[model samples]
Target: MNAGHQTTRRLAAGAGKSICRSCRDSLSRNYASAAAAAVQTEDHVSQHIPPVAQASPQTSYQVNAGVVLSRPPQITRDLHPFESAFFLYQRRLNERSALPFTRYFYYKERTPADREWKRKIKQRLTPARDIGRYKGYGEEAWNDEVLVGAKESDFNWQVERLLEDAETTGVEDQPAQELTETTPSPLAQKKVEHEAVERPMSRITEADKKNDVKSLNRLLQRTLYFLVKNKEGQWMFPQDGLQKETLKEAAHRVLEYSAGVNMNTWIVGNVPIGHYQLDYPTSRKTESGLNELGLKTFFMKARIMAGQANLKENQFGLQDFQWLAKEEVKTQVEDKYWRSIKNMLAER
Candidate 1:
């Protein structure tokens, strides 16, 4: 009975081992078939694949460097009406709160200078507190001038007229013309003449008056830019194609080549301040002998410190030029071009 049981156990163990071996063989065959199918699919795809197409003449945008040359404000801006009134009020307030004139310190006691100063002050100026107390306004009022007084309600005149009426009579303020008996001494007269007033030049220039757009002297208080009309009769900033140089170097060349080498301009930096991508259908040929589909323009900032543009050479094939303010530039150029460079201009 024991021998029979051992034989039965051996047979069962052999059958289980044979079954495990068959399952392993089937898995290996399935994996091998799948790999072969994948290889065949890859070969079919490779046979059907198309050749890579080459780039045409206009594979990309043509790199261009544009210069935004500007003349900064030459003078301070004019004060608006409200600004003027505010400044006037501030000056008056300061004058009102100021310390009284130290007569003894500024002038000697009872000397000719002191006597002249006293006479002048009494002749010209009247105290605001002492005004209207008496009808007489002293000797300051002239025969032809109207009699003036500061009133409590201030109804005799508006602020536009008779402002600070008691401050100065604006008469006989000049040094005595003749060196007669009542005139100041020779030394005093000489001193007065020595400190004679000098009038300042007007802010408005002849260029502004004549509306000369070429002159740099116009628009003293606003930034003025350089614009030129191209052969197409469109106004734009001076620009040129890049070649074997950095963006800033290209800008300097553009300014010199287009605007002329006479200008004393300094580019602000190596990096561009603004960029404009234009789809310009250009007939101009590139080094590749192919037409450029468009231009990728990078704008660099430059300031004109001294000299002006020399458009006489016409090296850039320009039609006309102008030095105009930002608003004027917007009016001259196309709307799309204006939108691209609008923020690059100085607000002042």
Candidate 2:
């Protein structure tokens, strides 16, 4: 019975081992098939797909230096008449104090209609009957004389009237010579002259020399306009009271001391466009430190003549010099100041 049992056990064990070996073989084959299929799929994909081309690092650096790095051209435009007038007047005025001032004229560019109109009217306009009257003067000469001589004469007349008024009580009254039989002392004469000068209504008369009158008149009439820049990149024309210097002296110093220009080379005209008043608040200390509401400023026009402005170190902290046209000035300057500038330009 024991021997039979052993035979049965052996047979059972052998069968179990064979079954296990078969299962192992099937698993190995399935794994091998799956790996082969995956390899095939990868190979097929790689053959069908194109390789991506990488961008070259060198191409981006191929910028043309000549084309991209050239300097920009300068932009400029024709100067306005005021600028030219300033130049001319400055040069002339510097040479002589009393200049025969005349309005500068420019030839208007005629349109097609204007040309046709002039052509039609040309034949109808008769030549002057009295040629002898215009014998010494051609059209150009006549125009020059009418503009220059007439203006000079008018200026002289105005100056004479002003001077006459300074000495006499009124035009209707007796002449100053008749009124005062005794010759006045030199000191009294000087006192009268000083009084007349201080009084705005007092006329500067013919008794005053042309140079003195011109200088004094310029001191009264001329305004010194200067452009200043601040740290924040804003622009302004700075002006202050005539602290110490005379008008002509101040004008020269404004260029020399403030603007740092070579005043010896640069010239300026005596005839200014006009004057305008500005008011502002101030701080005062009478009994106690207090804020005052009383400060006044008079701005007058001064035109540049010959040399360019060579800026210097100034208290106003100006960065650059500029000539703004009326239109540009109107946009940048304050309303009250712009109005003054506009009026001055209009006088041109």
Candidate 3:
């Protein structure tokens, strides 16, 4: 009976070992299958991911979201006319200020027809004929005269009149000067002679010259406009301001200054990226904020022209002040950049 019991126990132990071996094999197969499936998933992700260029639209959308939030439509619209006038006036004023007396005199000596045309322009706000209809003057020349001659007061008066007429008539009526074709009167000739006589007998003082240059410069700078295109690509100017010539100089100065500082890459092709990665991070802390670096630079340039070195330096944190204060990093950078520009211009 003892020998039979031992045989049965041995058979039972052998069967138990075989069952354990089969269970271990099944577990190993399941783990291998799971690892293989995970690798396949990883490979699929690597193959399907978009390249940088292809994802540009998404990137653009992200960047523009910030711009849309910070910039109001009215701000852009209001600045356009001011910037255009600023640049236009600056150029003309600079040219006039730089010329020899004889050359300037020759330029002012218009022919009989030219005087008549100018009289017609002064008599009416509306230009009756197309710019091309004028014999000697092209679009550029005509625009220059109209801009330079029409001061801020003149524009204000014209706009006021237009608004008044619009309110009264329920529509704006075109000025009648466009329909009138009057020859230059004797009074116009006499006025021209009087202006010629009033021309400075000696070279203008430095201060006066600087003032004239600044006036025109400011006008041109103020005239710059920002426009947006709709889906159809039609651009509309929405701002109103003085247009001056100095704005071009300011823009050139900015580009040149930026290039000198090894910032040309930022200015040219990669503004959105640079703004996101570099500028946006710093913009959140201040009142004027981070996006105003370009505008700050423009203002600094204007201040320099205005002969307000102390104020200009203060804006850049170059001015020494008592006590502790949080200094703007960009102001410091721009201050250094502009100093380098001044040095370079001096060398030239």
Candidate 4:
């Protein structure tokens, strides 16, 4: 044989030696792996959900599309002690580094708003953002964990205003000569423009005070997940058997079926974020006599936008339900199941 023919034969031998190593070794994996059917069966066995025998073409899992329905944090999370100190340090650094804000640039020499701004600066002014749900005042600038007691009617702004009103009443109640000394005019209140203090509603709602797990208003500062109790009293996320539809379609159907259509929810994506599997105690047979082995649950994330779940009717198989935080959910769900699913949950 010629030199070129010999080189072609050697190349063929090398190719034969390195053939199908990954196909044979299914345990091997990579983050970049776009693994399809070739790696699927081996991974299933590794998961130990159903026996290796059950991975055959005849045996099958009852595929379920689960909705990890959640209410995102209504308020910012509370800072840790270190975080708070660090932020305070950073603020001081910023204060030292920054040039003094020149009043002449933005404001005329003296006006009501400008005077108010000046008076506020003397008291170390902090402007409040008035966004509807996530709003907070000076002292209430972090989490919305407030005491919804009998005293809830006394919001911070109103309390301060009431004190001011009392002081004004004292001044008004004084004799004419004393009033002359105290006030530029008896209508001193008129001089100040009667700055109205609009009392903001307390963040703590009735649902929070009651510690109602069924209600969505419990934790304003933490993500709340939707869970349903099965007929056996096993608590898990709302899920249903997949029909002849896409995973996302099945997830929507499952959410509506298990939790009712009263809620306005948005599924985060079309694909599953996590996978979990569990096998039945006994190997059951399908209608076609193939082994009905176990369950394979595909979790898809969704956020509750407007309404809440109505499990009162119990129209579906579920008997009880709750909107629980991640830690609370871990306590309720099975250890193995929680282990399979915990990584998908929000840290806080």
Candidate 5:
């Protein structure tokens, strides 16, 4: 062949050698990897086998000792009395209660109609508020002892007024009767004394008195109130939870989270105005991992200095909010909870 043909054959030969070398290197790597895997498999089997099957008894002993030393020891200490009490309280709060450990509400002023409406509502419900089977003995006893007592006092005041009118009329007509018959015996004297003793005193009882004008005047300032609809659809004051926070912090956070009131627009009070217990449905025994059937909720109240409840799109499940008038609140809230709210609003 020619010189060019010879050169072409040499180049082809070099290419074939390079290809063969690459294939050899790949095969060698695969064999080395397979040998390493086989060795690992044997080691694994040896470790899992019984100690008697092992080559050396000392090796098994050493492996067991290493495992024991690798594990860390668990240590615990007993809590202090106060600390234990606090933990117990917190545990109860967790197991028996819903998320919100406390609540805060905002109250403005009240109108004249508001005060009047509250007073009338209280009067209407006072007689039978605790008469239902749902009420406990404590509530029944309180109603009988306190509310019934006040009613009796008012009745006595009216009787006293009637007695005063009778005494006056008797004195005026006594002269005419004296001319007709002059029978003044000790029996008649005793009867008169008896009538006097049975008659009501002229003084007015506390129950008969009205709300002072000054106190009512303070409430009659056309104050607007605010309430929020909870996840349950009950209308209540905007509230939030307390997570290891002070009452004020929790209140402000509640205003922000539930009411969606911006910090710049909203003004909040530092101190809480009132407090109350909120009744919530307890979780089922299976769900709560406890036998308790009730939840203990503690609520607090605070005054909204300024800003309206502008609930945002992502607010805490708050369906809606409103700047409610007194009449609106009376229609919205239940009687028992409203009494506490009315007291807060009508506070002097």
Candidate 6:
């Protein structure tokens, strides 16, 4: 009872002292932290308050200096009614008179030498043999005959005989002398001259004359029928069909002719007179011979026309005609270009 109890009491006293010391250390730390926080808060307040006061005047002065001067109020005067109307009318007239790129087409047409050269080159290469054959000169077999001063009728006869021989023997390499080159009958010469005079000025060579007429006839017939069918509505030709290089060439010829001129004739139209400011290369062949906006306008019109029109089907269940109308055909040519751009973007 004496020794064990005393030892236990001593251990409890030591533990109590240790707990009190720990509590005192915690209190001291808490007080020190609180003091430091108070000092920091005072410093922050002091710093911010002086800056705010000091900067307020300067900021106010700067803002006041930066203020823009108010502009004077405009006069409330209005134009007279007649003046307004006249101005509007003049503006409209100016707008109507201003053709954007139509002048370029007319200018290009006026200068026919370049087109003639191009046509000649094409004729020299392809020769429009089918047309020549139909005209009585088997293909362009009479090119040399015509060049050699053979009479028109004589050339025609030679062409007919050559075509007949070619058809029968499936060979176009017949001897030149073997093809009869008799003197042309007077009646035949007169007929040839009359037809030649009546023919539209085109890039058509003598060999291509018959073929051009035949092709034109086919196109005209198809166009007429298509138009008749859609007499009550508008129509558009599919651009994809006319987008062929050959067809484009044909279209260019048609356009050239429709503008009231050809490869040999001067341009005759209500051509606008203005300096053409082309944003693109003039030498390059554009879809509608117009800029991006013009092309868009054309396509939109075409889409409207196509939506309103009825599509004609041929005996073979194919579209017999290439272009429905000039506008539609122009649109078809232009739509392909924008669609191509859209496709490229989608891929990216």
Return the top candidate by TM-score. 1
Output the better candidate (4/6) by lDDT.
4
Candidate 4 positional error at 264, Å = 0.6
Candidate 4 global Cα RMSD: 17.3
* lDDT of residue 296 for candidate 5: 28
Mark the 10 consecutive residues where model 3 has the least summed lDDT: 64-73
Q: Give the lDDT of residue 335 in candidate 5.
A: 83
Task: Report the Cα lDDT for candidate 6.
Answer: 0.31
Tens-digit lDDT string for candidate 5 (99-204): 2222112222354444333333333332122121112235443322223333223434435544543343132224435522433454335333213336533333
Task: Flag the better candidate by lDDT, 3 or 4.
Answer: 4
- For residue 70, give model 6's deviation from the true position in Å: 62
RMSD of candidate 1 to the truth, in angstroms, is 11.1
Residue-wise lDDT of candidate 4 within 1-348, one digit each (tens)? 443445445555677866465632332333214344546777877788764454477777889888899999987765665554454445434443332556566677766556545444432323221111222345544543322332322334435544454333333244567545555674653634444556545567788899999888778888999999987899999888888999989888888888878999999988899989999998789888778789999999999998878776645678889999999999999999999999999976
TM-score ranking, best first: 1, 4, 5, 2, 3, 6
Which candidate ranks first by lDDT, i.e. highest? 1
* Model 2 score (lDDT): 0.40
Worst 10 residues of 6 by lDDT: 61-70
Model 2 ranges with Cα > 4 A deviation: 1-226, 230-234, 263-273, 281-294, 346-348
In model 4, the Cα lDDT at residue 289 comes to: 79
Q: Quote the lDDT for 173 in model 1.
A: 54
State which candidate, 1 or 3, has the greater lDDT: 1
lDDT of 3 by residue, 94-125 (tens): 54454334433544556654544454444333
Q: What do the candidate models score in CA lDDT, each in turn?
A: 0.71, 0.40, 0.31, 0.69, 0.44, 0.31
Comparing 3 and 5 by TM-score, which wins? 5
